[model samples]
Target chain A: MHLTFYTIWPCALFNINRMQSISSSSYAVHFNQRAYDALNGHLSEKSYSKIFIVVDENTHEHCLAPFMGRIQGTYDFEIIELESGEENKNIDTCTQVWNVLSELDGDRKSLMINLGGGVITDLGGFVASTFKRGIDFINVPTTLLSMVDASVGGKTGVDLGPLKNQIGVINQPEMVLIVTDFLKTLEERQLQSGFAEMLKHGLIQNAGYWEELKEVSHFKLMDDLIYESVQIKNKVVLEDPTEQDLRKILNYGHTLGHAIESYFLENVEKKALLHGEAIAVGMVLEGYLSKDLVGLPEAQLADIKNTFLGRYPKVDFTEDDIKAILALLKFDKKNSHGNINFVLLKSIGDPVIDIQVPDELYKKAFAYYAEN
Target chain B: MHLTFYTIWPCALFNINRMQSISSSSYAVHFNQRAYDALNGHLSEKSYSKIFIVVDENTHEHCLAPFMGRIQGTYDFEIIELESGEENKNIDTCTQVWNVLSELDGDRKSLMINLGGGVITDLGGFVASTFKRGIDFINVPTTLLSMVDASVGGKTGVDLGPLKNQIGVINQPEMVLIVTDFLKTLEERQLQSGFAEMLKHGLIQNAGYWEELKEVSHFKLMDDLIYESVQIKNKVVLEDPTEQDLRKILNYGHTLGHAIESYFLENVEKKALLHGEAIAVGMVLEGYLSKDLVGLPEAQLADIKNTFLGRYPKVDFTEDDIKAILALLKFDKKNSHGNINFVLLKSIGDPVIDIQVPDELYKKAFAYYAEN
Candidate 1:
């Protein structure tokens, strides 16, 4: 899974080479120079009527120039730049993109290239999937979070109000292009935000991967680690594309994580947390529950708590916050008929799905996180 | 294809019998009492968190009471009604319904019952399909247009501004239930509006069916024609679900028909035409093109024109209206790279797809429809 050498594509303007190719569901994630080559080849092969490059302000400024510099193609490209930030990740943004595509003569044969973080890929993929019923699209994920997780899964959507990804469809992109170089532009906080998911990947599926992550103290953005995270997610996604049975393992942290994310996002008084930040808190709390309910070893529970707490700053959940977050649990996507279901751990790397935690335990889970 | 006898459903509260079932791709089109039986079984079998009955104003008043009176099985239901008409089939309306469903705690396991015409079925289907990624939904089409055409095909969408079906997805419902009794409540205009699609069915695929439709002087709502029409459409849909090649033939009159429909719907001075009314004008015009360009026999072309005009009142297309209508043609769903493609007839029951009509013939097609 390592990029040992570089080979230039014949028609490429820049010295691009293959990174790594990982298969997921119906599509593949092409990394580094391979991604650029894939895009270039895609541009040449598909007689796309039009190609739309979707970018938010951040990517439009930081990542787009480098992207354009590296990619080579002879097709008319439309730049559809959206406003940045999580707040803009809603249906209104989707409507704007849809209107832009329609106004610019984007027919069914047109192709959309989503070139930003999760918000852009999610919203752009959704817009492409629904525009005139649907149109072909590709993803060029530029952030650490998107590269590792969102890029692999065909989970495209927009937030419904403060609810994350409430309205969307699971339509695969042609291929996901991951250019890790773009991650250099991310702030340290953003990098940390994304690394949380990598940690999550280890906790749920592979003890060796968790130990490997534990060995590294600096939270380095290693491409191998990123690739491993993607492979883990892609495996789960492939097994259950529609999030049935086995795929429920992917929601190990997401059940409570999403509610915490939504709670912080909506409350005017609190600061909004990045997805990984909230999910980290969720993993810590859920790990505590896992030990008590699902037979996750006490030592492993302590290890999970310490590992997340070491890298990610622990959120101080007030009594009020805990109550609201619990109420929000019913809105978790995993729930069926309002029963809040959790994916807990039997032990390190061994996950159990559909474990119900009593309401009384939710308070204890929070208290465990709050303690030193 | 006629209902010869009635057989009672075992769990049915009343003497509801199997009508006719025509299978589409993954689902079936159940007609009459069979529709009720299908709904009964679906409700009893699946543990849906909630049931949502989507209706427009017309169906809410005239259709809902009877629907409620007939449907069996104990399940809590929510009634979500929208304003009636094509104008209400947009994202704003989708947002409203989504908000209502979200507010009422509609989860992933919820079942959406679209109990109206194309507006309800199309809009409701799109909503259900995209809600929480996707959800189970059933369509109980109350209009003839819906029963014959929209029901069999999994084409779900809403118009974008004046553009017909500009924003939508191609998603199949759990099943499509057609109760012909609902058509009795429709105005003559509405029923006539639906019959145009049936005429399309006869003209595009079955010459014998075309002759049969021609034999009748009045546009009578017949269940046999509805079933046959649905079966014809179902066959095409099954052959090409995504409208790649064979399905493009479904767009026979729709290229110009949709533009004409959009033009009339958007214009301030002109009264908005029903979908079928505008499509009827399109059929007459496109049929003339077919005779000249695609070698549709002159007698059959004349027959097609007379058949449509006899039932549907002729829409007077002014030169200005024709020009505007032609401009609107580029936005047709069938177009690729701004190329206005038409599905012209080689003969009655034989449609040639993706045929580009010359610009000069525009006025002539309009004149052919206007003259006696």
Candidate 2:
């Protein structure tokens, strides 16, 4: 029996307009112009003992200069820069950040501003949350993927070896400020990678949203699109902060996506796929599985394959590659009691979670993806 | 100006008794025979896909064999052992444990039983708390220090360099089982070391209990003393789980004790001090400071010094050693805005938090300790 659970969070605390910020519990997510004011207001109000801005090499150059110019507060803050990439997102990186915070005498009252992509946000959030048993942290997501997905969830962690997010905690940041201005600095491939998650938000929750997103041929800094995606994810997260049941739906494509991502990352022969690109392939394969196992419409499955394959280049997974990916599935965070669980769509925007897909069907799913 | 805030946690959820288990928000601390039953019952009730018992070298050899014989469940469990010492309680150890858990396919439903002293409990708690954004964990504290201190607080972390608990989270375990039977295997020094924290519980909060603890000449398996110490700490932690105010009293000697411990551990010439032994010296020095800074009575200060010095041999610190220990004070976790904050007793059991000490008074306190 499939354990499907979804609760469309009332969005009771959110303000939809660009002028207003979305508040949840003790924090808020500020967008575009509102983000600038939120950061200014937060710094102006709280007398933090010290301030730290954590960034990656890329964000230090591309985002920090503009952010520093626009930010209203004149407080002294140290810039902690890490090497940019998913490869550096590990305990060692976290140790370096923690040591920096400690050596710099960051106490309970200090504030940490995570100022980069998912790697920076994730690693910074984990360090801040665990440092001195937690300190105040705010996220200024520089990458599109981080702004819409990583920043919204409060999921802070570093990857362990080839395993993705194997070590982390689900602690919310004090605030998340998303400014589309950083998008200009992103490479085309990076921009496309983030767009995949936005596509996911639409596919898993709102059919109309999927249709609207599909019409946009080029990626741009659209406040409305970012806001909507954040709203969808925030709503789900707030309803189930611990990801006990309802939140599992968010991992619809991630089950296979994460394994595939890890496999490519570990194998020297395979080119490293960006998170969104890997998950894009995962969506197509899972879409086929959904049609076979959950009676999703075959036409909708074809549409999903066509849409994702058109945007993300198809990866040629040899049988050995597929076997390695399958081997990595046991490490999926969602799995319990040694059972591999999947979240599949019965129809567009309608998901069924905890469905056990047979190995034979998994082989067929790959076969279908290969043909596409 | 001292920022003193104490909210006597309503004690709304606690049941004080020798026979009954003490329940917290998400966990319980089971004592003596009750611990065995609690473990058996927990394992029987929850069908964990895999069971892992994490221990240091000491516990694996001394405690694991007997623990295995007594455990009622028939489920197979893996033994993940680490080296026995504070030096091993770092991110690297956590990485090792995480890798083992990952290699063993420890999913969200797997259960990890931390069976050892403070180092094991702290490191294991941190690893379990972060692995897969948390999994089910039960701490089986073998040492007296862990039973009364680490087991009560939801503080889980590993040390960064020489700084104590520099990186960690305040996430509680599923339960903690305290079996004094393991104490028989402990060395006399280790036992005496743990006794210091129990002494601290009384000195910080209950003068009457302090008088009673002062009367003991030998360290034995006194379940009642253990229970009371646990009760005192649990009360303080429950009131201020985040250590924002009232809970600071628990760190009465810890500020100096941690620095001294870290100092000794880092210097090759200085012998490693057990957590409690360092804190014992810390209590004596702070007790002198309490007399000088907070009007703790001279006679009570003498009694505190006499009682601890009689039990723990004095470690002669050269002028350089004093300076090094004092310099390490800046790294204390309680410091804020670069100022060292100490918890001093106005009288035995009556403590004040966030009291800044002047340099002259600090030097005088060290001179007093040296002379004593």
Candidate 3:
């Protein structure tokens, strides 16, 4: 199903024609302008029983019409609008979608398009995976974070209460269409949240991409680089579809990031951290953990902190808060047994997964904030 | 995996020295006397992590120890007892088993041995199947009906509210051990309930078996014929696993039986019809439906009706009540679209599936019951 997506780019911007590819098995991560075009073209060719585009209430009001218009298909499509927010990402909402699908007499042949941010994609992907055992779905991520992060991997689930992704299965989507144009409609906070993951992609895999991104402060200039980030994620995910080994590296900032996200979610008055924003902080803190655990070069650790601190200077947490966050990390779903395994950078461009840090190192990592 | 189970029976009564082909999926369905020998064999050869014997409350108190003592093994197996009755067959109870399994760190290499009647086998099979996607379970059916019906087919599920087997998936057991010795512990009603299914199995598939069962009034007389009934059920199940086509023959009495079961479960003060009892009555009423739908011979219908009528007599249901019962059949999970489908007999031994009878015929089937 080939599709043509139009992007509103500046006249003088060097448009590299952003393309992304996602793989579940050990398939090479293919990324270029042609790959994205090919994927879109492939989807447009199939005649489905129904075109069901699931979105959150926010995205339904914001992004659905243009998405329907952009697709070349002449088929009629239906929208299942879900409530927007992390709190609503759960099995209850999945029941609602199941009801809608059942009421509509959706058969094995129907297509479910998740067109929104992470919640829509995550929940929609989960619903499709479990509906009648399983079915096909495509992800059209609108948020910058979802475009670069959620779109590539098939990690789809709703939170089980405060326990994130406790009840879920591993199922990959058939295709993921990441259009950076959707980023234009995002809130600045959401934009920054997504950009953090993109920076992590550069930090963990490609030094050249990191150097290039450092030179450009124009947020729009990062749009073309989303494909590069997706490529790195796809490579990691494809190698370990079931998260047995290599995929743990992608959890770089997520260990502490999830704890922070869960903490703020419970303390409703506190500022909510978008996943990417929390993870950006997590990446910095985890970078310090890497320095302590793996003897990462001190100079490289300073560079990682300075780059994130320069962009996100307002993030402030006391050592006590870090202690609390560290406690939350212990309950991370990824952790097996009692070990608090951290995925840390071997260097600026390499991530080594399953690195265990001692309790004292966690204190030292938090102490770095005081020294700074 | 090899598991040895024993029943108190003379060695001369059991047979099966001729069939000795061993494959990876080797499961021995020990019937009656042969079940006694199974208990006397070495269990480690059965390849099981932990031997978990599932039984209901009633079975636990009355027969658990005797059954356990008969099944000699090097290691004393843990008895995971459950509350008796169809009411306890649900996700909550399954959750109890899951919690136990999780606490025990039961892996994919574990085995679950279901010991009781239909409830233990069905619910236990479902718990094992879904615990870690799937697991192996052995069904040791103590009741006559489950021996021939439930144990043969891999249909495992708990009821959804008043609905029978509503939330379930199809998964076959690794082996079925039919130990009729346990039948001595059953109440008269439970024994009769189980006999009803065995009669229906004979009526639908084996006319000779049906004739043979006619001479057997007590569990002791039918003990000799238990193997014959189970083999018929196993053959039919092997031919059609999912009940998509010919598997419906097994549902010969189920159409009206299910409606009757559901009706009593909701309105009547007395206990609901046991599955076999309900299906037994269903066979007689559906014999009338089959007369028109499949041109079932009058002599054959009369034979079916006379056999069941002689055994069960008639349960009271007003003309209005029969109409209501027929209406409830419309919501049977087996029905596709809006039609009420049935497995009607073409003759005493030939069964047809997916047969849709007209509303007038449905009314006639029940009206015939009232008139007779």
Candidate 4:
């Protein structure tokens, strides 16, 4: 199946024709220009008994209308709207979606289209996977973060209380459509939050990609950059679907980054940080640890700190905050037998997995971030 | 790895040596005598970070002590007990289990042993499969129903409200250990509930087995009978893991049986029926439908009715009850595009799928069942 999507540049100055589409053996990841046409073509190739589109509030208002207008075929479909936030990604939302599917007489042959950011794709993919022991689902990620990170991987789940992704399963979708145009609807903070993941894809695997990302001064959603990030993540996931060995490298900054994200999210007195913001701090701190423990060059560590700190404002973590974050680290998913394993960078694009960082190193790493 | 277990029959007079163990490519289904020893040997071969045994209150009191005493290795293990019933098989219970695992530092390397009936295996399998995006789990089914039915099939899930298995995923455990000795602790009715599934295996695929089952009078726990049932189910499941075509035959009477089970369970005034008991009624009714729709021999249909009716008590359904049960049939997992599909038998050993039974035929089948 093939589809051609027209790109309307915001400036209206240059109508440059660019095709952004990447295909792995199992599925294809389509960018904004071809997303609608690709979806339309895919739908036409197969017959679905019922069509259910799941979207959060943000996408329902901003992305749905334009997406529906571009479709070529007339088919019966229903729209299921969810509250737009990370807080709503839980069992309750899954129950609601499951109930809606049941009430609407959705069956094994039904097709579910997840049409939003990470929360929608994660929760919707999970719901689809578990409903009647799984159903066919497609991902139309509407944020830069989801396009670059969530959409590529089959990681689908909801958080258990303060812990993020504590209950989930890895099940791939039939296809993933990455629409970079949706970034136009996001706030600067949200857009930047997504950029952090793109930056991470480069940091963990490709030095040239990391250098190109460093040159991205202004926050612009480029199809090529998003495509490159998807390729990096997809490659890692394909090589290690179960996170046995090679996949651990993808969790480079996620160890402490996730703890920090959960800490800020759960602490009422502290300002909650977007996933990217929390992980940006994580990358900086882990970079310091890498320099000390993994023989990473001090110059490269300083460069990492400068690049992240320039984009993400530093948080003033009190001693109590540090203790709480450290405690939360014990619950990190990467840990096995209570040993906190960190994926530290050996260089800008190289990562070493299962490295145990001492508490003293953790304290010193925090101190370095504070001093910087 | 192999281990031999000596069966100490509850009645010393029946000390017959019975070898009841079956192996598939990935796992084994061991009968009472060999179950514990097999489990011990399997555990010894693997090194786990921690061991968590999940059981219901019934199993904790009646089975846990015996199960623990049989183990030879010294390993740190925790007991997680939940209320025993179908009512507790929901997402809330899953959350409690996940919380316990997280609190106890259960990691990807940790192993979970499910030691109860279908409820324990279904919910525990789901928890292990989704925890940290999946973990290793073993099923030690301690009830006849679980041994003959739930133990062999990889289907794991919880009901969504009144719907049966509306939310779940299909994930196989590392191994499944079935001990028929647990049947000694069950009430007569509970043991009979399991017999219905054994009867189903015969009716769907083996006429000779059906004839042998009809000859049995007492509610005795026979390891050979259990083994045969497990072999039948395992063979069916292995052929069609995803229930694409051949597997639907496994749902023989489950189409209406599940709806009836859900209706009775949800209604406060109505008495809930055990899964096998409800399905026994379903098989009788569907037997009549089969004779009418698929040209099954009238003599065989009569034989099926006589065997089941003689064994299982009839459930009186009011017209309103029938309507509610019919409404619930629309939510059957085997359904596609809102069509209610039934797996009906053309003969004692022959099964057909996707047969659309007319509403009038359904009424007549119920009438035939009532008259019998």
* Lowest lDDT 10-residue stretch of candidate 1 chain A: A1-10
Deviation of model 4 at B60, angstroms = 0.9
Worst lDDT run of 10 residues, candidate 4 chain B, spans B1-10
lDDT of 1 by residue, A122-200 (tens): 9999999999999999999888888887887788888887678889999999999887888888988888888888888
Each prediction's RMSD over C-alphas, in Å, is 5.2, 8.5, 7.8, 5.0
lDDT against the true structure, each candidate: 0.84, 0.85, 0.70, 0.85
- Estimate, for each residue in B99-141, the C-alpha lDDT of model 1 and write its tens digit: 7777777898999999999999999999998988989999999
Residue B90 in candidate 2 has what lDDT?
93
lDDT of 4 by residue, B1-372 (tens): 111223322211213336667776477776655766677787789888888889888898898777777776677788898888888899889888898898888888899999999999999998898888889999998888998899976788998898888889988888888766788889988888999999999999899999998888876748778888989998998988888889899888899899999999999898889998999999988998999999889999999888888988889998899988998888888888778888999999999988998888888889888883
* Chain A vs. native, model 3, TM-score: 0.87
Report the Cα lDDT for residue B135, model 3: 60
Best by DockQ: 4
Query: Candidate 3, after superposition: displacement of residue A250 in Å?
Result: 4.0
RMSD of 3: 7.8
Compute the DockQ of candidate 2: 0.71
TM-score of each: 0.95, 0.94, 0.72, 0.94
Q: State the lDDT at B234 in candidate 2.
A: 87
Which pairs in model 2 have colliding backbones? none
lDDT, candidate 4, equals: 0.85
TM-score of candidate 3 versus the correct structure, residues matched by position: 0.72
Using TM-score as the yardstick, the better of models 2 and 3 is 2
Model 1 docking grade: medium
Docking class of 2: medium
